[model samples]
Target: MNRTISALKEWLNPDWARHRSVPPFEAGLRPNRRLDEGTALLPEAEFEPDDVVIRDNGEVVFSSGDGIFTLADGVVTRVATLGGQVGTLLVAEDRMIAAVDGVGLVTIDADGAATDLCTDAELAACVTDLTLLPDGIVLATIGSRAVPDWSAALVADDRSGRIVRVDGSRAEVVAEGLGWPGGIENSGAGEVLVSLGFDHRVERRAVTALAKAGTAVGTNLPVYPGRIATCTDGWWVAAPYARNRFTELLLDEPELLREMTATIRQDQWFVPRLRCPDPYTDTLQLGQLRVHGVIKPWAPARSYGLAFRIDQRGRIAEGVHSRADSDRHGVTGVASRDGRIVVAARGFRNLIEPQKDKER
Candidate 1:
């Protein structure tokens, strides 16, 4: 059987010796129109949000290149301008902390006064997500050190991603050689759950033993997980993009991947984006597929949007999706509070509140 399987692999992917393949989306992560059933909770805009958090005062805010902004009474308002693009936001003790591009992490208080927390030279960029541990330590996932951004890092198969711990003015890398650690969250049990994008799994590690790669809580995920926020029962995880079999095949052929990267426009690369911007040119004609809303990729939606929940023990709870054919792609952030769920469909440039939202 082993020989037959190997022979089949050779015959199917003859050009590549590596056995790279896409994980199945079954069980709790199955595809559905749950996200499409959702309503646009916030007014449409070009904010290009990365993460959103419900403040202690019951204010809804999100992180974007334009900085932190609040949404209330169906109106969006900027609360602070951190002087650079923001990656993630965390609310702690009446103040908000954000990962600002080129500036490290900055704390914004009630008055929107921005103060630098950790300006470590290494973490000046590529900070993916942030979470506060029970012991007050702040953990951050550095997507990669080899590339300036995620697209380049994934294309180059970069493995410099790390988990950094921040204590007041000190910041140090405790875990290294990660596969695009895109999301971080505290486990209420004193452990931390990290979503490994390239590895396609969620790992659990002791805050003290982060030097270890930890154990898998969820493995062989179908989507590249992103920012995760604690929910009433477990945690809500965002998937900015979904896996593509063709892309996986392309990845196994390094020479071909290299040549394509060199010759093709970055925008047209077989990579995921916030949305299928130019339907005509996008590997998939999502625009044309929407007969009234349906279909996927000429290739899959490099524009897939998804979010799921994992129980405290890392068991899959439930999930939702925008589908490759849908414009609601790149769901990078999710927050649930006061019976209301807010999802940042960054690709769609909108926030979604599923039909199940009780508050609204």
Candidate 2:
């Protein structure tokens, strides 16, 4: 497939190629509706964020699909195209780092030298989220997929998914069977907090026994919680693509509340895709065809962006990539350190706009 067409296909039918084997009826589900507020129209100008990074000295670094975007105090200073999907940026010790999709991690040291820190295979494992530990240990998510395309669905990917620890060439799986883990953060006590995307829950795993010992601390979040951050006190989980509304289940006992919450099903007839038979197979097969409550890209108020934060207990101190500044589709990658938000937004508006121009 041509690169442009393939990219557009990934954008248009995000779940098609990977979920082909599963029956459509089983695969598709109607989403539970929230109180339908009138559709909200955010200005297009506000949503045009490129691959960007921030430096410690108040320098804004960004790339617009082609070159580097130089900024001083949040104003664009220069622009240069550095080809690739720039995911997350890390500013450490006077240096800047950009995690590019497919091309491992790149670090620009103090003297402005850029170097690769990890390998492509290590990155292709889909390191959706990352966190830097005090002792040079970097925790990242290696998400699994039922079929490769299913991963595009932004749901479950448990089989091949893992929480990996990277300390310069020493890569190890600390946690396994994590469902499309979208968020990673370091707990103040040396533990790693991860968001189980498909499962809609938050988890904490000790750094040492990450492969084996870990437990789910919070459960039953409303929708897919993408980015997570931690501060001096508690935590913040962002449900970027959550149902438009939320409700608190006021139950007496925590255990009873947990049990009751687990029983709620957003789509009863939608068959959940679990795993694949072989590692190499990427196509999905549909068993049945059913369409109900399917989300359309043209629908208003259907934005999907990264949302999460870390703060004091019982109160959210700071938040991230607000719903006001998000796109309707595409995978959004998020990471934060010391209160700075690094975001990577990927989508295919280029293909659509050109066609619209032709018709006009």
Query: Which predicted model would earn the best TM-score?
Result: 1
TM-score, per-candidate, Cα-based: 0.89, 0.56
Q: Model 1, range 1-360, lDDT digits (tens) per residue?
A: 655676788889887545667767777777777788898866677678789888666778988775789988788888899868898999888888899888898999989889999888766888999999866788999999778577888889889998898998799889999889999998866688899998888888887798787899887777788888988788898989887776777776678899989999888888766787766675532233444454533335567778898987678877877765568788989998865678888888888876662221
lDDT of candidate 2 over 233-273, digit per residue (tens): 46545444442221111211335444534674423212222
For residue 4, give model 2's deviation from the true position in Å: 44
- Count steric clashes of candidate 1: 1
TM-score of 1: 0.89
Angstrom error of the Cα, residue 33, model 1: value is 1.7
lDDT of each: 0.81, 0.46
